[model samples]
Target: MFINNTWYVAAWDREVGADGLFSRTIIGVPVLMYRDSEGRLVALEDRCCHRGAPLSVGRREGDCVRCMYHGLKFDPSGACVEAPAQGRIPPQARVRTFPVMERHRWIWIWMGDPERADPGLIPDTQWLDHPDWRSQDGYIHYDVNYLLIADNLLDFSHLPFVHPSTLGGSEDYASISPKVDRLPDGVRITRWTLNTEAPAFAKKVREWAGPVDRWNIYNFTLPGILLMDSGMAPAGAGAQDGKRDGAIEFRGCQALTPETATSTHYFFAHPHNFSIDQPEVTASIHQSVVAAFDEDRDIITAQQRSLSLAPDFKMVPLSIDAALSQFRWVVARRVEQEQQQAAASATGARPAQTAA
Candidate 1:
């Protein structure tokens, strides 16, 4: 149910280079990624065209890669430039190349329609590039459908239950309904818990005394990238009015990269405006986030197992599903558009562009 013709984070900036080949599956496509001689990132199909050997096992020669099994060398354009015993290269001796882009210390790859790969389509995440913030990041591999993991994020009501000790405890936090903004390509969900005690993790850097007004805003771009804006200030302060001075604020990002129909890669980074000079602040945020997200992984895995065993079973939505329901609708519409375009192309029906 993954959508093609879009960009997905293939790996973190640190995950792809300064070493041998990086092999991973994105949307069921096995890709071989590495840095070239000029320090450019290149992604090609991992399978060799001839003997079907994994190209990742081969070594790099200048800007191209030489297959270790046979002496076939492929340039960055995916064209086979050299052959061992054969003097002339076969016209079919080429691998598929995926469009790759690096932004915000992450590597993004387009899985389909190389001509339509747009860098502007990549989500806006300027906070990661901001100089005033410090961050900590981590990765997790989940054995579950990517959409299920997205569902958990769109519906934040689980925070109080799943992360009681870390992010939630008050009944009011989970009971608040989110204000949803239906965008052409994504969804924006904002929630406010006024004059409430800050969660355990937030309490570590709370600026004022007593209860503070807390706000959470989530901007989810299509496919699986999220920018979360969260902050807390004095009860009477204008936190919602954008008067964030002397308040505790943090920006968090979460990206889900589908490896297969039933597996995904979770990448996240948390950057905060407060406590920028304290090393311990970053450590605290990272530890609590990891602990909470690990709980998220455990729960999602269990749900995936249950659904796998009972493929026919359907779970009904609850009252708190307003935002998640919208999220599902947006994703479903995009997936349907992709399917229709693919089908039309196969039958030469002149595919129609979907209206946003």
Candidate 2:
């Protein structure tokens, strides 16, 4: 159920260090990543073309990686350049290389055709490294499908029940329905809760005299990327009207990469524009967000277990399911379109070979 042609978050920039080889299973394919001698990022199929040994366990020789199993060395392009024991390297002795790029403190990899990997299509997440905003990188691994996490993100009504003490503040979040708008690649959801008590985490970061007005506006894009602008201000501060005076602003960035059929790699960070100079404030916010996510993970994993037991059971829809349903449709359509295109290409290639 994965979109093969889409770009996915391979890893945080810090995960693959200058001299370290990192490997992870993305969409069930093992990927080996590292920086070349010139410091350029490289992503290649982890399996060595010879004997099927993983290249991650091999040794790095300057800009190239050498498979220690049979003494075959490959360049950054995944082309076999040397075979120590053979007179010549076969033309087909090469591993597949994926299109990879580094931006916004994350490494992005295109899992399909290299020719279709356009850097411009990558989403903008400047808050991740912008000077005005401050945040720390956070990553979590889940033993559940990535789409399940996406479902959790699209609907906020569960916050009051799932994240009661942390992200959830009051029942108003569950009672008040949000506005869901369709986007070209995904969906946009906006919700406002007025004159409500701040969540426990918010109170730890800033002092609130009484009730406040808060807004959560975010865009969940294809391949599971969420960039959000959520914040709070005093009850009469006019935040809902677009005035930011005396407002505590935060930017939420989250990326979900499918590890396998029932597992996911979650990368996230919530940056705050207000406390740019205070590292403590950033740490507190990060800790709270992690705690809240732990709560989400506990319930989502339990639900996944139950789903496995009842594979034929269908979930009933509710008003809160609007955004998630739309987002799932967008995903399904893209995946179907990709499958159709692949089938067409295969059909066209067969005819060209027959004519030749």
CA-lDDT, candidates in order: 0.86, 0.92
Q: Pick the candidate with the highest TM-score.
A: 2
lDDT of 2 by residue, 260-355 (tens): 999999999998998789999999999999999999999999999999999998999998899999999998888877777777788874322211
lDDT of 1: 0.86
Question: Could you say which candidate leads in lDDT?
Answer: 2
Candidate 1 residue-wise lDDT, 1-356, digit = tens: 88888889998888887657889999998999998876789999998888989898898888888899987999988999998999788899999999999998878999989999999998876676678988876899999999899999888889988998887747789888889898876789999988888788887655447788888898987788889998788777888888877678888888999999999999898888877889899889888888899999999999999999998997898878777778788888888888998899899897777666
Clashing pairs in 2: none
Backbone atom clashes (below 3 Å) for every candidate: 0, 0
- Runs in model 2 deviating more than 4 A are 349-356
Name the 10 consecutive residues with the lowest summed lDDT in model 1: 202-211
Worst 10 residues of 2 by lDDT: 347-356
